[model samples]
Target chain A: MAVLQAILDGLMIGGVYAVISIGLTLVFGVMGIVNFAQAEFLMLGMFVAYYAWAWLGLDPLLAAPLAFGVVFLLGAAIQRVLIRRVLKAPEVAQIFLTVGMLIVLENAALLMFGSGFKSVSTPYQTSSLQLGPLFISVPYLAAFAMSVASGLALFLFMRASWFGRAMRATAQDPMAAKLMGIDSDRMHMLAFALGVGLTAFGGAVILPYLTVSPTVGAQFVVLMFTVVVLGGLGSVAGAVVGGLAVGIIQSLSALAFPIQLQNLVLFLVFIAVLALRPKGLLGGAR
Target chain B: MNRSTLLRGLGLAVLLAVAVATPFLLDPRGYAIRVVCLALLFAAMAQCWNIVAGLANQVSLGHAAFFGIGAYTSTLLLIHFGLSPWLGMLVGAVLGGIAAFLISLPTMRLKGHYFALATLAFGEVMRVIANSWSGLTGGPVGISVPFAPPSFAMMQFKETRPYYWLMLAALVVVTLVFVAIRRSKLGYRLRAIKENADAAEVIGVDTTRTKITAAVISGMLTACLGTLYAQFQFFFDPDTVFGVASISVRMAMIAIVGGIGTAAGPILGAFFVIPLEEFANDLFSSRAAGLSQLVFGVLLIGVILIEPRGFMALGSRIRRLFGKGGRP
Candidate 1:
């Protein structure tokens, strides 16, 4: 019963994990360079939502689009100014450039917001629904619902939109995509923006349950990477599977170990995955 | 010796003289000397990183695991059994080497980003263990080295001059190792592997064994430096030592900024980066909390943007401009 309940709770939170990590995999898909600063954008999304709730009395769910919009622009600008230069550089340069961005974003947030944890007070913050022998936290359920909706919307956009086709084309082959009249650079900027925007959207939705701080992104860095690696680097469908698996793994490990050692289990799994399956369990595509 | 070799030898002697004489010129207890000491230590750490990353192109982002292992092993030994840090350093090196070997066995086949990601997770695992295993690591509050009478045995000294010299010696030793490796049969094999691993393998290079050897050596050297750091600072926590940004990224950044593959690169990088960072911290700590770190991030970005090959390339470019038409 406890194991079943843990799995249930895991799925709820895992939905958000999937949404947050999709951006990471997406950026990797479009641009071979992994944005180490991807989590910082999630932090930014949380801040945006926090401010929206505090100043405008809007719920974080309501403010999720705003967070996405703001971060999307920031992501686009960053891609143009910073990431573009490193596109052709060596892997070391690419890695460090993103790391430098990570440091900059975290410090900039620290300077702007100070080193304080900010939380939102929602009416459903402490509420829960009992399901026979199991229970569902309202915040988790709401966040999960938001993640599913956004994820579905993203799927629609990818399958139905011309821009999505162009992005996918670019990811497949830049020269071929360019010959097909798709602006590869524009696709890159769009993909980066859209990727981080989705992650920021996840950040906004989870604001009711999780506190926002400058260093909050540090917490998710390894977790997100684990998810992406498990699902495969560039595969969107894989991130969903990876995220749920990670969430379940975390919750189950919580059941077995002390709370402090929870991340230790995750880190071990991450290393094991990377060591054994560098292409990811689901196999990599774009 | 030829003219260039003689000139290089003369320059090194002059640099060594300057280094030995620097303590007398500055206030022995001053912050500047402390910064210089830290710079030397970091340079050694970066040099260790360069042996693998710069030479073999196997960029590791989790060196802090070995660093933290070194610090904790020595400090714990001191607290528990009254073992001298000198002995503790040797123990730490052995353990670090073993840890490196264990990690390398599984991850030796991985390359580039996959290798980096695996190593990163490895470092975080060490940090989590250290933080949680409070009985051993003393938890997040951190551990302080017990103050004993100023002595060489404990690796503790009252004056900063000894530490500066110790760090300089360490830098020299690690730099020598780097140069030796670069000139060795192993060095040529590593370069071949770096250029094309599969091709090297086809030509009879044991790619896995060579990579594992480099990683173990790098890890062991980094651990030794960690002991030096433990003695220098006298207080540390898992976060500070096993920290991603503080130890891992900083070491890699130093190597990258100076010149990745060169013997002089980490030294050049450490001298440039560490002092600039200290100056930034001094200038901005009072104004804002994260301002100094922000400056660090900006500087890293600036360096990457200006020259991905780092200061070594910039130096040659300037020399080429000045020596145009004078040399072949």
Candidate 2:
């Protein structure tokens, strides 16, 4: 019964993990560059939602779109000014550039927001629904629902939208996409923006349950990478599977170990996965 | 030796003289000397990183694991068994080497980003363990080197000058190792692996063995530096020693900013980056909390944008422009 309950809780949190990790996979898919600063955008989203809730008395769920919109522009501008230069540079340059961005964003937030943790008070913050032998926390359920909706929306956009098709084409082959009249550069920018925007959206939805701080991104850095690697880099659907798998792994590990060892288990799993299946469990997909 | 080689040797001798005489010009207890010590230590760490990352093209982001292992190994030995840090450093090197070998066995075949991701996770695992194993690591509050009468054997000193010299010696030794490796058969094998692993294998290069050897040496050297750091600062936590940004990223950054694959790169990078960072902290710490760090980040971004190959490359580019104009 306890194991089943843990799995249930894991799925709820895993849904949001999928949403957050999707952006990472998407950026890698389109640009073939892993944005190490991807989690910082998630931090940005949390801040945006926090401010909206604190100042306007809006719920984080209601402010999610605003968070996405704001980060989308920031992500696009960053891609143009910084990431574009490193597109053709060596991998070391690409890695450090994102690292520098990570440092800048985190410190900038520390300067602006101070080091204190921020949380929003929602009516459902302490509420839960009982399901026979299990209980679902309202905040987790709401965040999970928002993640599912956003994930579905993203699926539709990718499947039905012209821009999405163009982006996929660019990911497949830039020269071929150029010959097909698709603006590869524009696709790159769009993919980066949308990728980070989705991560920020996940951040906003989870704002009710998690505290926002400048260093919050550090906590998710390894976790996000595990999700992407497990699903395979650049595979969106793989992120969903990886995220749920990670979530279940985390919850189950929590059952067996002390709280501090939780991340240890995750890290071990991550290293094992990278060693055994570098292409990801599902194989990489554009 | 060839003319260019002799000239380089003469230039290095002059630099060494300057480095040796620098402490005499500065206050022994001053902050500037402390910064210099830190620069030298980090420069050594970056050089260790360069062996694998620059020559072998196997970029590691988890070097802090070995670093922390060195710190904890020596500090714990001194605390528990009253062992000298010099001997503890040897023990730490062996352990760090073993850890490197263990990690490389599984990850040696991985390339580029995959290798980096695995190593990054490994570092985080070390940090988590160090933080959680409070009985051993003293938890998040951190541990301090026990104070004893100032003596050479203990590796503890009251004045900063001895540490500066110690760090300089370490840097010189690591730099010599780097140069020696660069000139050896192992160096050529590493370079071949860097260019193309499959091709290197086809040509009879044992790619896995070569990579594993480089990683073990790099890890062992990094762990030795960790002991030096422990003795110098006298206090450290898992976060600072095993930290991603503080130890791992900073080591790689210094190497990159100076010039990867070159002996002088980390040296130049360390002298440029560490002091600038200290100056930023001094200037902006009072104004805002993270302002100094923000400046550090901005400067790093600026460096990458301006010249990803680092100051060494930038210097040559300038010299070439002038040389061409003068000749014409």
Candidate 3:
């Protein structure tokens, strides 16, 4: 029963992880550059949602789209101004440029919002649903629902929309997509915007449960990377699978180990996966 | 030797003379000398990073794992068994080397971002362990080097002058080692691997073995510096020592800013970055906490955008613009 309950809790949190990590993988898929600062966008989203709730009396779940929209614009600008410059640069430049952005974003937040941890008081914050032998927390359930909705929306966008097809075409072959009269640069900007926007959306949904801080990204940096890498970098479906797996792993590890060892468990699993399946469990070149 | 080489050699000798004479020029217990000592210590750390990232072309982002290992190993030994830090440093080096070897076994084939992430995970693992095992590490409150009389054996001193000299000697030793490695057959193998791993393998270069050797050496040297840092700071925590941004990125960033794969690059970079950081902290720390870090971030981004090849390339670019005696 405990195992089953852990799995249920893991599934809920893992859905949010998938939503957050999808942006990372999507950007990598399209641009072939890993955005080390991707989680900072999540931080920004949480702030957006927190402010929306604090000032507007709007529920965080309702503020999710606002969070996504704001981050989408910021991400577009970042992709154009910063990432565009590094498309042709070396790997070190790409890595450090994002790292630099990460430091700047985190510190800028510290300067602006101060270094205090912020959390939202939702009506559903303490509510829970009993599912026979297992229990599901309301905040977790709401976040999971939002994640699923967003994931489905993204799936539809990729499958049925022109912009989504163009993005995918660019990811598959940039040169060929260019030949097809698609603006590869614009596609890159769109992909980056969508990716980070989705992560921001996830951030807003989970804001009710997790405390928001300038340094919150430190907690997710390895977690998100593990999700993407476990499924496969640049693979959207892989991120989803990886996210759920990581969430399950974390929850299961929690049952056995103390809270501090949670990251240790993730690290060990990450190393083992890298050793056994260098590509990922899904096993794709991307 | 070529004219440029001779000129460079003379320039280095003069620089060394100046560095040796720096403590005398500054106050014995002044903050400036302490900063210089830190600069020297960081320069050594950066050079160790350069051996792997610059020459071996394996850009590790978790070197702080070894650094923290060295720091804690020696600090713990001193606290518990009354062991000299010198012996603890040796033990730390072995532990660090073994840790490096273990990590490299899994990460040897991973390159670029994959390698970075894996090593980063390794570092976070060490940090988590240190924080959780409060019985040994004292947890997040941090640990302090026990105060004792000025003694060489304990690696603790009351004045900053002796520490400055010690750090300078460490930097000199590490820099010499870097130069020796670069001139060795192993260095050539590393360079070849960096250029084309598959091609190197076809040529029977044993790419994995060469990379592991460089990583172990780098890890051991970084650990040794960790001991030096523990003694110098008189206190540290998992976050400061095993920190991804603090130790790992700073080392890699310093190496990049100076000149990747060049012996003088880390030395030049350390001098530039460390002093600038101190200046920023001194100026803005009271008014704004993260302002200095923000400035540091901006500088990194600017450096990347302007010239990813770093100061060495920028210096030559300036010379080229003047139509002066440069590479051309």
Candidate 4:
């Protein structure tokens, strides 16, 4: 019964993890460049929602779209200015450029927002729903619902939209996509903007439960990588599967280990998964 | 010797003389001497990182694991048993080598980004352990080296001058090791593997073994430098020693900005980055908290965009642009 309950709780948290991590995998899928700073966007999103709630008296759930919109524009600018320059550079340049961006964003946030951890007070902040032997926190459930809704919207966009198809075509082959009259560069920009925007939305939704700090990305860095790697890098479907698995694993591990060791468990699992299957469970590319 | 070789040898002799005399020129108890010492120590650390990352093209982002291992091992030994840090350094090197070997076994086959991510996880694992296993690591409050009577055995010194000489010696030793490795038969194997792993394998380069060997050496030397750092600072914690940003990235960045695969590159890089960092901290710490790191990131991005091969390549680029015989 305890195990089942843990899994239920894990599912809720895992949904949010999937939404945030999909952006990372999507960027890799489209451009073949891993943005090490992807989590910083999530950090930005949390700050956006925090401010919205504080200033406008809007719920974080309501402010999620505002977070998405703001980050989408920022992401597009970043893509145009920084990431686009590294499309043809070596893997080292790509890795460090994002790393540089990570350092810059974290510090920039520190300078702007200071180091205080900010949290929102929602009506459901302490509420929980009981399902027989299982208990679900309201914040987790709300975030999960938001994640699912946004994920579905993304699914529809990818399936039914011309831009999505064109982006997929570009990912499949830039040269061929170009031949078909699609601007590959434009597709990359769109993919990057959408990718980080989705992560920001996830950040906004989870703000009721999680605190916002410039360094908060440190907590999710390995966790997000673990999820994406488990699903397979560049595989959106894989990120979802990996997310639920990580969420459950984290939830179950909490029962046995102290909170301090939580990230240790994730790190070990990350290393093991990478060692065993570099391509990930759902396997993105060769 | 050929004229170029003769000139290079003369240049090295002059550089060594200047290095030996630098401490005398600077105020013995002053801040500038300490900065110089730090630059030398960091240069040695970067040279060690260059062994694997530059030569083998492995580009590890987790070297802090070995560095912190060395630091904690020696410090613990000294605190508990009054053991000499020299002996502790040796022990730390052996342990660090073992750690490198252990991590390499599982990750040797992985390439590029995957390799980096795996190693990064390993470094964080050490940090988590250090922070949680407080009984051993003193937790987040950090550990202090017990003050011993000023002595050579404990590797503690009262003046910045002796430490500068010590750091200079360390830099010279590590640089020699780098040069020797680059000229050895193993160096050829590493270079071949770096260029084309599959092709090198077909030619019997033993790519896995070669990479593991480089990692072990790199890890061991890095551990030695960790001991040097622990003694120099007189105190440290898991975050500073095992830090991804402070130790690992800085080491890799120094090597890259100076010259990734070249002997003089890390030396050049350390001198530039450490002082620039100090300058940034001095100028911006009060008004803006993250400006130092912000400056660091901007410099890194600028370097990569301007010259991915770093300043070594940049020099050649400049020379070629000026219509010299240097290759672009």
Which sections of candidate 2 miss by over 4 Å?
A284-286, B324-328
* Candidate 2 Cα deviation (angstroms), residue B312: 0.7
Q: lDDT per residue, candidate 3, B129-184, as tens digits?
A: 99999998999999998876779988888889889989999999999999999999
* Segments of candidate 1 deviating more than 4 angstroms: A284-286, B325-328
* lDDT tens digits by residue: candidate 2, B103-210: 998899998878888999999999999999999999899999998788999999999999999999999999999999999999999999999999999999999999
Q: Model 4 clash pairs?
A: A231-A238
lDDT per residue (tens digit) for residues B1-328 in model 4? 8999999999999999999998889999888888899999999999999999888888888999999999999999999999989999999999999999999999999988888889989999999999999999899889998889888878998888888888999999999999999999999999998889999999989898999999999999999989989988989999999999999989989988998989999999999999999989999998888899999988988888888788999988788899894544
Q: Runs in model 3 with CA error above 4 Å? A: A284-286, B1-6, B325-328
State each model's CA lDDT, in order. 0.94, 0.94, 0.93, 0.92
For each candidate, what TM-score against the reference? 0.99, 0.98, 0.98, 0.98
Candidate 4 DockQ, CA atoms: 0.84
By DockQ, the better pick of 2 and 4 is 4
Report the lDDT tens digits of candidate 1 across residue range A1-286.
9999999989998999999999999999999988889999999999999999999999999999999999999999999999899999999999999999999999999999999999999999999999998999999999999999999999988889999888999999999999999988899999999999999999999999999999999999999999999999999999999999999999999899999999999999998888888789988533
What does candidate 1 score on TM?
0.99
Question: Would candidate 3 be rated incorrect, acceptable, medium or high by CAPRI criteria?
Answer: high
